[model samples]
Target: MSKVRITQVKSVIDRPERQKLTIKALGLGKINRSVEQENTDAIAGMIRKVSHLVTVEEI
Candidate 1:
């Protein structure tokens, strides 16, 4: 399996509630914070939801 790096590049403030929750769920709340997760369909879907707030890189 492959892994992906999810980095919180932008602040979640003033964003929708869902987006804020999604950021926290991904283990990120502050900008520049990052988390490594397995590259899967579910994770991809989540990333799609908040693509504007995060940057993802395949590892």
Candidate 2:
């Protein structure tokens, strides 16, 4: 499988609890933080949940 870089580009302040949790599940907590994860269906679903709060790049 391929990998993708998921970077938290926005704050989770005032966002829904579900979204906040989704960001954390992606291994991110602060702006500018990033993590490389497998481009799996589960990860893609999480990214879709918080797409506006992050940036994704193929790695």
Best-performing candidate as measured by lDDT: 2
- Give the clashing pairs for model 1: none
Q: Global lDDT of each model?
A: 0.92, 0.98
Q: Can you give the TM-score per candidate against the true fold?
A: 0.94, 0.98
- lDDT (tens digit, per residue) of candidate 2 on 2-24: 99999999999999999999999
Q: How close is candidate 1 to the true structure, as a TM-score?
A: 0.94
Backbone clash total, candidate 2:
0
User: Model 1, stretches more than 4 Å misplaced?
Assistant: none
Write model 1 residue lDDT over 14-59, tens digit each, in one string. 9999999888888889999999999888888889999999999998
